[model samples]
Target chain A: MVLSLTLLFVLSSGADGRVMHIKSLFASPLSEPRVGAQRTINLSRGTKVSVVTTQDPWVRIRFAAGTGWVLNAVLSDSPPGKTSSLLDSGADVSLNARKRVSGFTSAAAARGLREGADDFSGSKFRPDFESVRNMEGGYVNPDDGYAYILNGRTR
Target chain B: MKQHVAAAFFVLTALLPVAGAQSGAPALSRARAHQGVISTEEDHGDLTAEIRFGRALAARILGQYKLSADDKTGGYVSRVGAGLVAMSGRPEIRFHFGVIESNEINAYACPGGYVFITKGALSLMSGEAQLAGVISHEIAHINRKHVVRALKIHGGGGSFASGIAAMIGGTSDSSRVILGSLMDRGMDLLFKDGLSIADEFDSDADAQENMVAAGYSPAEYRRYLQKISDAGPGKTTSILSKTHPPLAGRIERLKQREGRLGENARN
Candidate 1:
């Protein structure tokens, strides 16, 4: 059938030892496939590795460091450009770096919503920072997320 | 000959996952599956802006509805949501999932990564797939940056020097006023205006890909929507019905999408 031929063509297009690069915005943890597996390493964005195998949502990859599993979503066939320094800098950038990054905040300042708008008062809805913080504090650890997937996966 | 090659390429792209599964190697990034509709790129606006704006909006939503104290249910949803988030193509941002104590069968996704599902909606889900389906839908909205793009809340410094204090030198009283007004408009969008129909359809399409890639049943998502539709237009379903397109229409579009992808293409 035509579909059969197309499938064959597609499969043949890709070869063994296919290379992929990390496409996640931040560093991604390469860990064992199983639930509660220890992280093998944290591969930064754009790190290239060879594909070893895959499970749904997890791909086993062979990097220079070692072979381990990574989320399939984090792998891209094409290498990504340099990650955005502004977004990736986090809270640790030096004072000079902050000056370079001040454009973003300056724009917000122009709009009257400066960087620290916490003292924002006179709102009809009493902003409940405490409750929001509590909710955010209960982040689901990646290990727990993997366990949930393992337990819930029917296939 | 050219037409034939094009057709083959289309089929190959569609069936890449099937080949990947058989070869024990990922065929292509699942992110590509969504690239047609929603680009995997996340350059909507400033990262700090999205988070701060989302947090502020979340606080207001919490102001309206108290969070459920059921740790078991909350933890379960959080775990499932987190797993999906890991593969959501927007892993850079931390996501928070909360269950609010509301009888209304609705869910809300804030601009950044805050997602809330009402207890009433929780009761309607029959199984984990159904829950995943719903959560995936909300995740789609967040990943797509629907609210953020619509609100136009952009540009903020990174988490440098306690972002607020760093801006104290530039603070104007008008900034507080502008932020408050922005919140008011945001509330209206959540409560009355609702996102565009195009956005809803896009989210549903993205959710289908998310569910299929995550090894959950995409059909179950349609089924969940059916369940909501069957519940009829009552108080519990009022807000959902008001905000979203008719469930019947959404289901039909999903069917069309799945048909295009072909059943075998889904995991």
Candidate 2:
């Protein structure tokens, strides 16, 4: 019965998402956590689990026995047949900006926030730069983008 | 027999995912679950898939940076990163470390014992311990399986699934273009906006513990954070937030943990 259950879990866990191999089990995402301890769930290498939630660097997953958290850094979203080189190159920031502005405008409208007033125009809050240049022996950029915060926007 | 059944039931109950799925279940809830199940001798086969995938991606990424395998600085980074991993108590897993030639102050870890530190980030470290803190924190991300969990929640089969799908539909050269686009998007999410406050705190706590494990003062982790904070706003371009919880909050947390270390510690 134990073997059958384990097999069931193994199969079920991999159905929805890629099976993530556990690298290390350090501290849990709970209060008063400790490190370098052994765990039953162990988060062993080759252990398969279904991703339940994703937010930033943390992911929530369900194993056969239960659900737990995983760091997004440790797992690959290995879309099949993708070239590794293409993924390594930097993303198109200009395209991202267009999408972001549209999203921002929609969100602002939903919240009744004003738009197109140049309220949130500035690069201090955003780290968009053409290239990171080493400036005059200091971390200053002669063409460093200006910093701007939209009125009523939290910086 | 009854006792055995009862014990099994207890273990199962402990292993069960937290119920109710409350949005505000205290940040430490996940850590508690991790602590409840960890034990030596447990099977970790699930981690292998991530390691294999990570190795392939790292190889490709490093190759693009033109970082030679024989580079001394790369070797130094690996040594320091591996040193922190050694403190994790599970020395069976060999950790691979590399320095990515980028001007972004970021460090990340992928499943399967692979960790990378960027030159931009390396240039900012004032001491070996601080670097160790960064490496240890990335290690903690691996240990915690943060990436896998995130993908499952956002959309199963990992983000790499889409990239792979793109590749399968095209030739090698075309695939490379697709892959690069996918990778760039991935980097933006991972480095620029994917990290959460909870994730940051977990890494912070793990770095502190790993520092102690490696025979360094955990307070050194605190000191590095203070230095970064002192560098003032905008000096460090966090892909996450313009200004994270001010240095004051981090200091307070460190003070709370300091009691565990005993007397004569300077504040």
DockQ by candidate, in order: 0.18, 0.02
State the lDDT of candidate 2 residue by residue for B1-267, as single tens digits.
322221221122212132211122235443332321212222222232343334444444454443423456664555556555533412333455666667656676654455677777778777766777788878776666554343221111223333223223232443233334333433333554454456556667666656654545667678776766676656345642431334567667766654543322223
Task: Note the Cα lDDT for every prediction shown.
Answer: 0.63, 0.44
State the displacement of the C-alpha of residue A26, model 1, in Å, after optimal TM-score superposition. 14
Residue B13 lDDT in candidate 2:
20
lDDT of 2 at B1: 30
Alpha carbon deviation, residue B222, candidate 2 (Å) = 1.4
For TM-score, the strongest prediction is 1
Q: Go through the candidates in order and give the C-alpha RMSD of each one to the true structure.
A: 13.8, 19.6
Report the CA-based lDDT of candidate 1 relative to the real structure.
0.63
Model 1 CA deviation exceeding 4 Å by range: A1-122, B1-45, B156-163, B166-172, B264-267
DockQ of 1: 0.18
Cα lDDT for residue B71, model 2?
54
Candidate 2 runs further than 4 Å off: A1-155, B1-45, B56-70, B89-93, B153-186, B240-248, B264-267
Model 2 DockQ reads 0.02
The number of residue pairs in model 1 that clash at the backbone is 2
For model 2, state the Cα shift of residue B88 in Å.
Answer: 0.7
